[model samples]
Target: MSLRTLAVVGTGLIGTSVALAARRQGVTVYLSDRDESAARTAEDLGAGRAAPPPEPVDLAVVAVPPSLVAPVLAESQARRLALSYTDVASVKSRTEREILATAPDPTRYVGSHPMAGREWSGPRAARAELFRERTWVLTPTRLTSKRAFDRTLDLIALCGAVPRVMGARAHDEAVALTSHAPHLVASLMAARLRDGSAEAAHLAGQGLRDVTRIARGDSRLWSDILESNAAAVAEILTRLQEDLTGVLAALHDLASPGPAVPGGTGPGGGGVVPVPGRHALVDLLDRGIAGVGGLDGAGGGRRGAPGRPEAPAFPVAGGR
Candidate 1:
């Protein structure tokens, strides 16, 4: 069914943002959360009424914890609370399987993820603009109804998010590499600073912030994310480790300039080449720039989506 009355199933940041966005679109929104207080708080923020769906709803958004989304969807479907169900859970494959095992008909069930969020947890940190212009993915199976899928896409557009179409396998694989692996890296790096001296932490600057911004996310929630996507995460991590080993070996060779070929040695053996002096270093830098340019085709502008047309850019001189 098309979206008219929407029931938001958890009043945390994502749910609250959804309510705010949906209301702005002139749709009726009903907010709910197991912690009824959170639902009330979201209502106070003008998200919606702190009540569950009474009559049938056009859309049900399960924005609860990753692990709880399946059970919630199953129950909602059983009780016929909504004509179509979707979730904002980060991981999808596991969630899809659980929903199938627990509730047979996912013809109306769709999986979704908005590639945007803050480290802060509840409604207080919610931003109506959080998902704006950000990529939002929907992993609809063959069983998913076209109406439900299209309405979900409409909801994504309503929230000012960019819509991406992907199957469950592709979606999981892509995020596992881009999102999940980076999070694990952030947490591992942040853990090193947990017990550092106050002086050391104060010495920390934007570089550390850039690296660990995501580490401050809810630990329990991330634990669920990592656990659910363990297989894909492990595969990505293995490739990362191999790259790290190669870099470390290169560093060792640099430190001890022996009879070694000098660049780096390996199977294909791009080999330990020569240590270039100043001019050579500059030449290598240019080569590196070219390499990166090749990876990023055309404008080399990564600030926008790949293959998407960007508005004309006006040149600005440095602060003169």
Candidate 2:
């Protein structure tokens, strides 16, 4: 079914962006948030009205953080807020499990996570085009009704996102590797600068900035995300730790004295010798290059399905 009305339950970046995108598609959107000011701000940005719908909306988009998804969904369901419900939470498995266990009518719900965001968050950072050409994952279990799933698909199309369906556990594992673990790694790398000397800080380059850019994400929100998907994230981090250990050992060997060579720092001997750890270091560097290159080789830039004609706009619905 075409989505005519949407009730966005959180007025943060994703929620506001969903509302803005839907509003652009002639879908009536109602915005709400625990933070009243945020809802008002989203309304000010022309996203939607900062008021509850007089009746149930076609769907309620729960745009809260991962940890809050289940409780917020439960409360929304209790209020009979919408005909169908979906969440934009980063983690899916835990939330889906909770909904199945707790929601009044889990059949009307489908779990979703949009693989889109800005480094800066909140309603002000939201844009209607934030999700354009991005992959939006839908994790519909056996309980999800066809109508609910179709409504969510309509929502995704309205937002110009390409939809891929995956099981909840698979979605969580994918994001743990792609999103959650990377955020933690970035933040950890950025934290190293906290104790650096002024000269060290001044010598910083764009590579460091690029590597640590996601470190600027909201700490509380990230912590919640990490906690919700702890198992999957921990698995990734464990592998990462093993990789780091190898890199660290290689670095230590490289720093240690090798055989003396004419131009080398080793003790003066006429003969040259192989540099310690050079092979390992070169191998690691090559692998890093290949890993990055493989992404492009695999058509990483492709988002949604190319050449899919835009669906006709939703029928304009009257505002309440």
Candidate 3:
């Protein structure tokens, strides 16, 4: 099924970006948010009109927080707000569970997460091309109707994001590793700067800036996200803690004086030898390099995919 009209709930960064992208593709869009001013801002930016559609829309895109997804979807479905519904929340398993329990028509809903965003938030930060070449995951259960799922695929195509399908639980666990846990790690590292002296602050370089860039995200939003996916994030943090302990042990060895060399003969005779666990530090650094290189090619930059089509044109209404 093709998407002609879309109703976007929550006119924040992701929501407004979806509306703007859809509108740019000639799909009529309606915008709404708890913050009326935000909706107005998105509307002013050519995303969509800040009003509910006169009739049921082809699809309703819920772009609210993970915890609010089920309630918002239930309300939208009850009002017949759209012929089909989908959400752009980060955690899918929890949202899907709530939808099955609370929504009037769970079959009409599919859970999705668009793996794209900027450090900034709100409509002002929204961009029509924010999702181009990005991975947008769709987590559809057996209960999801074919018609609803197809409509969501069309919406993802319009947004120029490559669609990847995964089970709800898998999606949650994947994001916990790639995003949720890393966010907390960044925040923890950035927090250390809070007590730095003037000289230390002045000596800060790009490495510190790069590592903590994501720490600038809205704290309340991140807190909610972390709480929703607590189990998965906790598991990743546990593994990270193990690695950190090893690294700390290696650092302690490096800081302590090593045993003197047996052959006491040259100038300053027995200079302290290299630390015994130096290999551990080198191995850790090597693993970090490999991990970063792996992420660089993670997408493989494939073409002709759902959201990465070559020669993409404006989607024709009622046409695939």
Candidate 4:
């Protein structure tokens, strides 16, 4: 089958990036976005033509917010805009459920999440290489057609993303701890700076920058993401809270200098006679800070670095 065109129903960062990538591969694209100006902008950038379906396309990519994925797919399928559909929503379970509950036949659709993004957003932030080398998840139910699956996977490969297959629930659960929870934690921490002292804000460095990067994402989009994976995110947050409490308790002991602070004991000499949890927490945090500094293949404390005395070579993941 000679596939010629793709219908991109959203023109935000991911959508525009998809258009740019597909067009670069010599595929024709049809563009649509609620924001007319944004849609026009993407077209002007040579992403695609700002036109509705001149004829039913092979695949439709609904690259809207997490909340709109299902509804948009249902409406698009209902109107017969594309023979098959897929989405680029970050969270997958709720959207998949919504698709099953709404679409006439969910078989014509696939739920996908690309594990890639940037702190910046919108069409201007769109880059054809956005998904390069990233893992793109495809959650296809038993009802999904082979044609749809093949077509969607083709698009994923064309985008330079490696396809990882998993159930929708598994996808959502994994991203909850790895992506969603981290975003919430970052936002909550950045919230502290809403009224923080100027000196503190100015002195902020990569530590705060890395943590708060996702905090700058579209709040409305994240609200939808957090809600969809609330159960899993809640579980992760509970564990994180437990860790945070440990860190705080440790700080309290040292700040007030319970009783000379040695021997891993607290004020009442009841801290932790052996294997102190507080001291362990401090050591873990120190290790984490040091490990992060070793990012970019650069090592610190060449003599006594926490992670490994000797650097593990550059780009451990890709052998860069």
TM-score of every model versus the real structure: 0.79, 0.88, 0.87, 0.83
* Candidate 4 deviant stretches above 4 angstroms: 257-277, 283-320
lDDT string for model 2 (176-225, tens) is 87789999999999998898999998999999999999999998888999
RMSD list, candidates in order: 8.0, 8.4, 7.4, 6.9
Tell me the tens digit of each residue's lDDT in model 4 across 101-182.
Answer: 8887798898888888877878888999888867889999768898888889989888988888999988888788668988
> Model 2 clash pairs?
none
- Superposed by TM-score, candidate 3 places the C-alpha of residue 177 at a distance from the truth, in angstroms, of 1.3
Which window of 10 residues has the lowest lDDT sum in candidate 2? 311-320
TM-score of 4: 0.83
Lowest-sum lDDT 10-residue window in model 4: 296-305
lDDT per residue as tens, model 3, 1-320: 37999999999999999999999899999999999999999999999999999999999999998899999999999999999999998898888888898899999998888898888888999999889888899999779998889999999998888999999999888889889998999999999998899999999999999899999998877888899999999999998898889989998986788655454467665454455667777788887776665554355133444754453343322232
The order by descending TM-score is: 2, 3, 4, 1
TM-score of 2: 0.88
What shift in Å separates residue 29 of candidate 3 from its native position after superposition?
1.1
Candidate lDDT values, in order: 0.80, 0.87, 0.88, 0.82
lDDT of 2 at 279: 64
